[model samples]
Target: MMKTILLIVTNIEQYASGHLKTGLWLSELTHIYHAAKEKGWKITIASPKGGNTPIDPESLKPLVLDGISKSYYENPVFMNELAQTKSLDMVKNDSFDCIYLAGGHATMYDFPDNTTLQEILRDQYESNKMVAAICHGVGGLLNVRLSDGEYMIKGKAVTGFDWFEETLARRKNEVPFNLEAALKERNVHYRKAFIPMTSNVVVDGSLITGQNPFSSKEMAKVVVSELEKQAFM
Candidate 1:
């Protein structure tokens, strides 16, 4: 039987001061979606608000576009899946073998501090399911707590779009808060590439994370590898 995965994206548009537009980064979803499809896993998209999640226009630039995401944009069926995404409230725990959070500036505004999302991560972690996030999407992990009342990410080695990447993108001032600073404040062992915007994926047990949009493909490969190992075991 093919495994099922739930991928979450943000519905927020403007990140800060309504200057920097935000939505799900198409590359983040496409790389993982295609990788999972090739490995025979079914994927579903969900959002905190649900319905008609938008894509960041910047992410759709020819230089950033991947073949899978470009194709996904043209496929009516796939577009409909994104158009009618399930709300976080409607999802049940333990239904998916893996849960991935895709990133864009919007995630910083909506993905973090969501109670429903926190519960989903808690349940997924407790069930030993693979939990992954990339770029700003790692913001979603900020509030997740384990059943024992400890932070799910406490002391874990993880990576996400770094503060330097934000600076490179020239949105350092527009972002509400510094994600790297926030994670470090919580005692999370956050890692990053030496250079900004490089592809870096980190896997620590059941938790997997990628540094930026450039890292999503590697992130997905790592997750699928873990899932395959678990399935055989």
Candidate 2:
């Protein structure tokens, strides 16, 4: 069966600080986008307010923009799709086999407390479907509560951008809240790499996560593998 993936991103363009810009991290989405595309999975991009999604300017820098991201940026169809993402309000949660939250510092602003997004997360998770997020995308999973009123990832082993990484990058002051702290508050078993900026991926059944942009592709591959496993059985 051909699988479908809901690629969710932040609509926020800048941070509260006003000096720094933050939006969707390109590689986080591009890597997973290509990976899923190679597997012939359909993907839909959506945001909370449902319109244009902002790609972080820093992500497009020559130093950061690799061939994959550069090609994605150059694709008019892909750029148009990102610029006009469907609204989350219009999304049917059960329509897709998986939901991938693409990360950026902006995701921290809108992902955690959005009730509608939480509903989608709960729907996908409780249905035994794959739910994955990378980098700041992990913020989306922080507040997802199932019908039983338990945090969706309470006992699940997961990995995301760590406090050490944030502090190392000096973004702790600019971010709205501490991601690692919020994960802990929700009783999540957060994991990270021994060294900052290193890739890390964690797969606990249907719940899959990657620590940073470096791990997004790996996370996507694992998602494909998990989907294949489910299809076989």
Candidate 3:
């Protein structure tokens, strides 16, 4: 039987700041999705509101988009998936072996405060299914509360789009909110790359988090590794 991966992304097309376009980070999804596909895992891309997920324009820049991401960029079939993402409500929590949140400035806006997404994360997580996110994608984990009425991240060591990293990228203000502060608000034990924008992936049991966009591919490898281990047991 094929394993299933639920790759969640943001549907928000742009930021309120204007002029700066935002959506899903192309490489974030491509790196992981392609890996899962090669393993013959069934990949279902979902979004909060669903339908026509947008891609961050900056992620497509010549400096960034290349290799697997560049290939996905030019493929019409892959492009169609962005326009055909299933809504969060359409997903059956029990069907997926893992749920991954993709990042972009768009995720910073929509990932948090979504009741449906929160429910899915909470249910799947409590059931021992794997959950992962990267960059601003970590925003989705900050607000997930457990059945015990405590924040899921309360004691978990995690990391994501850091305020300092955002500053280094010179897009701190462009981001919707201070994700670092929000995670701390729930008493989340947070950490970051020793060097800014470094590829950092933290594994705390079933939950995995990445420090920045650069961490996406490695993060995917970690998830695949975990899946491989689970297959043996």
**TM-score of each candidate structure, all chains considered together:** 0.96, 0.96, 0.96
Q: lDDT (0-100) at residue 23 of candidate 1? A: 86
lDDT of every model, 2 decimals: 0.88, 0.88, 0.88
Question: Which residue pairs overlap in candidate 3's backbone?
Answer: none
- The better-scoring model by TM-score among 1 and 2 is 2
Worst 10 residues of 1 by lDDT: 13-22
Question: 1-233, model 3: which lDDT tens digit per residue?
Answer: 46889999999988887867889999989999999999998899999987989999989998778688999989999999989999998885457899999998899889889999899999989989899999899999878889999988888999988888778767877877898888888887888888887799999989999888889789989999998888888
Model 3 accuracy (lDDT, Cα): 0.88
Return the lDDT, model 1, position 16.
65
Per-residue lDDT tens digits for candidate 1, residues 159-213, read 8888888888888888888999988877888899987887999889999999898
Whole-model alpha-carbon lDDT for candidate 2: 0.88
Estimate the lDDT of model 1: 0.88
